[model samples]
Target: MEALLIAIKARILELAPEFLQFPLGHLLSITPVISVFAGIFALTTWIERKGLGRIQNRLGPNRVGPVGILQPVADGLKMIFKEDVVPRSADKIVHFLAPILLVIPTMLAFSVIPYGNRLVPIDLDAGILFFFAIGGSAELIVFMAGWSSRNKYAMLGAMRAIAQMISYEVPLILSSIVVIMMAGSLSLVDIVAVQTGGFWNWHVATPWGFVGFLLFLTAALAESNRSPFDIPEAESEIIAGHMTEYSGFKYALFFLAEYLGLFAMTGLAITLFLGGFHAPFPFLNWVPAPLWFFGKFAILVALFIWIRGTLPRLRMDQLMGLAWKFMIPMSLITFAAGATWHYAGKGLLAWILCTPMLLGSYVYLGTALTKGQKVSKRVYRFAD
Candidate 1:
């Protein structure tokens, strides 16, 4: 405990050396990061709503400010002023506790996410594992919320939540292993540093790299409850699931946790495979590092949004099957493929040797996609 305290003190001191002189100068020094992130988080929420609203051919929150510019601010006030309710049958303590519990870890998970070279607050050596460990909190607190809600729907939602997360978490971890193996360290900084030169150095360039990328992408979607994987809280079936009885600010807290989770997961994807905070292409590395990192981050987030707009939620059995039968097995195959290529000694020969397998996988996936079109056509014809 003493050692841990000392380490924490060191981190705090590192965050602001001016504290020694001005007594609270570090707060000012770190103010930009906190305020900027807070603003970004709030703004992103509004952006998502507006965009989603646009997709549905409606104006979203346009009354809050011009074009709903102050919409988040209004929403914030609404949540803050509203009376939080505990369901009559709920476990009051757990119900009250769960939303806060869910939100904190979602925010804290960003600590080790390397924003840029030297931009991180504390880039732990075990960043990848830290990310994995922290993410588990979501599953736990969500269960707490669901179980505490004292509704059968909430209970079912919580069950689905637990099952869904556990299903995807395996592939998430396995996919990350491919990265840890490639970078030879669990640190996000080290991962980025290894890919310093250009696009070719990035993991997505390899056979296992492609496999790992797709695995991480799918698992991340599952982890975040985005679209196809959003079975736990599917409105049509479960009626908000774990958060069924939460009201006002408590509901907002759940909403914030989700968006923050999306942000962190996208950042994680950037760090692990896309060369966190790196420029998109080799030639663009000449641009400032922060721009490069954030540029890539933005692209991934946009991809996530695009997907949410495009896909329908998966059925529970479909969700479970995809994880167990597909994601897990594919991730393992990817990790092995990555390791085997590295063992063959990291060069043109390694790339060449992996080419056939890569081609085969691509062909198989392509054929599968085509088969879906054929099946869909038959289904439509039969319906007609």
Candidate 2:
């Protein structure tokens, strides 16, 4: 299957005139990735709305298309036709440019991830570094959106978003660094290559890897401005924060950039810890590699939606406290644990040694952090 796709791509490039082939080759590689993720973005909106409605005991958007499956189309049309409103007092150029800037970096970050067997787009030696570098630009764009708007609420929201990102970004990068330490390459493709043999060889199978995966997932949620970590745009408080002033397609672009970033980060997680496109069992290798990658991607996306519905937004103080007091410390511990696992020969001795220290640190952190907080049993009052 992989060879067939490669052959088809090579054949197309061969047919193109020499001067156009360079650009044409890139177009072929890039177009499919954009198309696939754009489709996923639309589908995820429907799934999230329906899933959240089900969680809340309601039917969501049933009138748009068969059970509201075409709602994303309807929403897109509305955004496109809606009036693009700019505040009279705002810096119009930056306000207009911020969303476009946000989309660019998010899209560029997608180039390095390996989606299937031999399917990396750019394959840079420092691919993972490139991804993070592109991702960090969103922070500045967020502040740009807020500052340009000249609205107090928007500025406040942007500030919160920046702080939230800086706080969580530490543990987020640290968590992935553990994988780099083990995999010994900044190239994401190489990271995926190291875990290819079987499920047991997958990084998440080890003690530090398991801890690292959890830490990465939590930090990714925050980095993407997902809920409980969504305090920056908490509508109840700051009214969309950095995005409060955006309207029409500009507003939609921010959302599109956000979902794309989510997809990119989630894809990275799958590559780093879930063994990329590798099948769980040797027998299942017959399944297409792309299928394995997307299957895992879907599960993680659903998990994100489920969490959004289930968890309430944290208070600002609590959010910062969690990052400083817990996440960073835990991530550092996981890094140490990964080192221990490496030195202990990745044998039974490594598992026996690292597991205890990691688990023990987790228990101690939880205990010590919660020691001063008073807890009382919930008393529910029935309303008639």
Candidate 3:
């Protein structure tokens, strides 16, 4: 990022002469760009609720406006006026700061997600690395919220929350490493550009690319704390986990942080696996780039909602086991396979389709046998 700053400064200075030449509209146009994004995020807030509502077969936010399009707006108003309540037993200072802590990292993470052609807020050379580094910031804030509450349930929730997030973060970074290796560049724009041609060019279809997509998605699911991986907030177990003591806008801060995190994760996935802002159709890249970015992103947002409705949360032990047992071993095996394939100089199509079958057969067969043994034990119990 520093190396690029030399040209960056020169370009900005070059534009400064023009900015002085025209006062109001020229400099002010940048304001609308920021507003557009903020609006987009706000719309996404609505989309998640309305979409999740439809999937779960119920009304989400109908009373506020027609089709509930203005529900987020109404909800925002309610939170703003609502009384701020902090537990009497809680530490005063940290409780005051925790909401800000939760939202700041989420805001930072979005800055690295490129929107479309040359539309990124800031494009660093180490974009993907910067992403993970910022992504981990939430765990810290989450733990703080749990600890500062000074509630027993809150403390236990914080520990569980930390454990779940930390475990999933490993596979999340490793899975993304596969993309860095394939694209040979960590910049999110460069990664998307490599998939510019069409659906086939998208990395998710290639061998290492496909495995990377699966691994990345699975890890991202955990990272976002979605169902089937949401051990932290299980009502049956942890009872809203780290945020149990929060209320009013304070609770809303954590709530918005979660949706923002989900929004960012979907955008990252689109950028990495689904070809970012490129049109799914090969020739469609010729169309304006923003359409593709929004189109793909909206589809992914729906998928995330669908997942929330369709899946059940994993047990805490099961969640832990998945990271250490399933995700870790699978990530290692996939990494090695990709490395070996690269070194062997095998054709991309051939290796991706064939390698997982040939290379992983032993492991697959052993896993099958173990499943069979479990099934037999269940049958025996039934018979007895």
Candidate 4:
């Protein structure tokens, strides 16, 4: 199957016109990636809504195409026709440019992600650093949207978003560093190459890797402004937060950037910890490489959606505390554990040595963080 794919790609390259061959070929290659993610972004909205609906015991978006599959289509049309509203007092230029800035960086991060064995768009030696460097700009973009709007709520939301991002960003990068240390390469493809063989070889299967994966997932959710960590746009409190002044397609662009960012981060997680496009088991190698990649990607996306349905947003103080007081320290410990495991020869002896340390730190810190916090049990009252 791999050979066939290579042959087909070579044939297509041969068919290209001589003069425009290289540039046009590159453009053609990237077109499908952009289109696929754009479509995925649209579909995700419907999927998330439906998933959340099921969780909450409600039917979601059933009026469009069967199962409301066309809801995103309808949404796009509505946004296109809707009036674009700009606050008269706003900085028109920056207000206009903020979404574009936000989206471009998110899209650029996609270029470094290895979708399959030979499917990377631009494989840099420092791909992991490049990914995070581009991703870090999102906080600035959020600030731009808020500051340009000149609305207090928007500005406040931007401040909160920045603080949250800064806090989570530390652990996010630290957790991934553990993987880089294990793989001994910053290139994402190299990272995956080291993990090949089967599911057990994947970093997430190790004790430290497992802890790092959990920390990475937590930091990812916070960084992306996803639910339970979505305090930035808490509709009940901030009325769309940094997006309060945006309307019509401008609003839709913000939504697009957000979901695209989510997809990119999830894809990175798949690459870093879930073994990229590698099949889970030896027999599963019969599955196409890209299928293996997207299957894992989809499951992670579904997990994010499930989390949104199950958890309530954290209070601002709690959110910041989780990152600084708990996740950072835990990620640092995981990093140390990874180094120890590596030097100890990656044997059962290594596991025996490291598992207790990792588990003990997690329990100690987790208990310390949650100590004295009251768990409220709800009591239902009925009036007859």
Candidate 5:
């Protein structure tokens, strides 16, 4: 599937005039990314609302379209027509620029992700590094939105974003570094190539890879502000956090940027740990590679939605505590284990050495962190 797309793209580039070819080549590469992910973004919004409604035992958005499949279209139109409300005290320029800046970085992060064989938009040598560097700008954009709003809730959200980014970004990078080390390249394509044989060769099949994958997903949840880690947008507490003062189209941009970030993070996770676009088994290799990529992507998105429905939001203190007290230490241990696995020649000896250290650290950390907290037995009271 991806090969055909790649061939068509090459044909277009070959047919273009010299000066236009360079720009057209890039346009061909990036246009599909933008279109596909933007489509996914729309589909995710509908799926989330419907999925959440099901979890909460109700039908959601059925009035909009058939099973509300066209609900995202309705949302886009609503945002377009809604009043553009802005605070009188807000910094006009920064307020206008914040959402735009946020979306740019989020979109750029996808450029390095390997969608399928030879399907990366921008395959830099330091592809993973490029992804992270572009993604990091989102923190600054969040702060800009909050500060420019001149709203206390927004400012608080921005502050929380800073703290949250600091705490989680460390562990996120550390977890990914294990993959980079194991694969022996910063190029995401190279990393994917290393795990090409079968599911067993995938990073997540190994001890350190499994631990690293878990840590990566946990930090990704925090990074993308999903569910329990969604302190910045705790609607019950602060009413949309940094987006408190935004309205209409600008507000919609922030919403779109967020889901884009989530998709980008999920793509990176697939690239690093789930074997990218590779089929799970040699016999399955005949299947279109893009199908495998998007299939895994869909499963991860559903997992995120399930988690959002199941977990309660963490308190600010608890969120910070988890990042620093548990995630960071575990990520460090996982990194060391990856190194051990490499030096031990990636055999039973490596598994024998690395697995115990990881399991022990996990148990000790869980026990240690909860030590000072008071635990009371659940007392169920029936409603009259």
Candidate 6:
């Protein structure tokens, strides 16, 4: 299948006119990724709305088309026609540039993710480093958006974004380092390649890998500003956070950058722990690799949407405590477990040693953290 794609690409390049060849080749390579994500971004809005509607016992955006499939189209039209408003007190130049900065880092981070076998856009030796370095710029963009808006609420939200992103980034990178250690490579393709096999061979099925994956997912939710970690943009508290002053298409661009960031992060998660595009069973190899990759990706996306629908936002203090006191320590221990497993030749004895260590840490931390918090059992009351 990879050979077929290569042949097709080469044939298309051959058919192009001389002047357009190089540019056309580059365009062909990048166009599909961009177009697919754009379409997915549109579809994701509808999916989240409808999923949340079902959770909340309401109909969401059903008027636009069948099951609200065309809602994104209507949304795009509305944003295009609406007035782009700027506050008189705002820094116009920085405000104009903020969304572009936000979206660029999100898109660039995807360049290093392995979508399938031999399907990376640009394979760099330091791809993992490149992903995190580009991703870190998102905090600066958030600050830019908030400061340029010149709103107190926006500024506060920006501060929260910085705090949350920086705190979680520690565990995020640490958890991923376990995978890097196990794979013995910093390249994303190499990471995925090491995990390829039957379902059990996947990284997440291992003792330390499972723990790392959970930590990674927790930190990822915080980093992407998804709920219940979405305190930065809590609507009840701060209108739209950094986006309070943005109107029309600019507001839409913020939303686009957000979902694009979600996609990129989820892709990275799949690459690192879920075996990228590898089939679960050897016999399932008949299915295309990209399909396998996206199938896993869709499950994780839905999981995020489900979490948003079900969980309430965390308090700022609680959020920081969770990151520093819980996730960071757990991530460090998981790295140690990975090291032990690697040295112990990943034998049954290694599993026996690490499993207890991981479980003990989780139980102890969870108990200690929730010690003073209220605990209640829900009593359901149906409408009469």
Candidates' C-alpha lDDT: 0.80, 0.93, 0.75, 0.91, 0.94, 0.91
lDDT of 6 by residue, 1-384 (tens): 765776788899999899999898778768878889989999999999999999999988889878789999999999989999999999999999998889899988888888777888888888999999999999999999999999999998988899999999999999999999899899999998888779888999999999999999989999999999998899999988898999999999999999998899899999999999999998998888889999999999999999999999999999999998899899999998999888878889889988998999999988887789886976678833
Tell me the tens digit of each residue's lDDT in model 5 across 1-384: 888998999898888899999899999988889999999999999999999999999987887878889999999999999999989999999999999999999999999999889888888999999999998999999999999999999999999988998789999999999999999999999999999989999999999999999999989999988898999999999999999999999999999999999999999999999999999998999999989999999999999999999999999999988999999999999999999999999999999999999999999998877888998987778842
Q: Write the per-residue lDDT of candidate 4 for residues 1-384, one digit (tens) a residue.
A: 545655666788899879877886677567878999999999899999999999999988899999899999999999999999999999999999998899999889899888877778888999999999999999999999999999999999999999999999999999999999899999999999998989999999998889999899989998889998999999999999899999999999999998898899899899999999999898888888888989999999999999999999999989977898899999999989998998899999899989999999989998988999999976678832
Clashing pairs in 3: 207-352
Per-residue alpha-carbon lDDT of candidate 1 for residues 1-384, written as tens digits (9 for 90 to 100):
223433564677777656373554334334544566667779877887787787778876788878988989988999889888787889889999999999788777787877765667577899878888999989999999999899999999999989999999999999989889888999888988887666777888777887888889888988888777888889999899887888899999898788778778888888888877777677875666767766776677777776877789988877887787677777777777787798889787887777776566656655643454334433465657
By lDDT, the best candidate is 5
TM-scores, one per candidate: 0.86, 0.97, 0.83, 0.96, 0.97, 0.95
lDDT per residue (tens digit) for residues 1-384 in model 2: 777878889999999999999999899899988899989999999999999999999987799879999999999999999999899999999999999999999899889999888887899999999999999999999999999999999999999999999999899999999999999999999999999978898999999999999999999999999998998899999989899999999999999988999999999999999999999997899999989999999999999999999999989988898899999999999999999999999999999999999999999988877788888977778952
Positional deviation of residue 303's Cα in model 6 after best superposition, in angstroms? 0.6
Identify the runs in model 5 with alpha carbons over 4 angstroms from their true place.
Answer: 377-384
What does the lDDT read for residue 119 in candidate 2?
A: 84
Worst 10 residues of 2 by lDDT: 375-384
- Tell me how candidate 1 scores on lDDT: 0.80
User: Order of all candidates by lDDT, from best down to worst?
Assistant: 5, 2, 4, 6, 1, 3
Give the better candidate number (1 or 3) by lDDT: 1
Model 1 CA lDDT for position 241: 88
- The regions of model 4 sitting more than 4 angstroms off are 1-9, 15-19, 377-384
Candidate 4 local distance difference test against the native:
0.91
Tens-place lDDT per residue, model 3, 1-384, is 322433454465566666563553333434444455567667877887877787878877778778889988887888888988889989889988988888887777777777767767678899888888998988988889999998877788788878988998898777777777877899998998888886987877666667667767778878877776777777777678888888788988888787677777878888888888787787665666767787887777677668877888877876787787777666676666667666766576567654665347537634743463344434465657
Where is model 1 more than 4 Å wrong at Cα? 1-34, 57-61, 281-286, 359-384
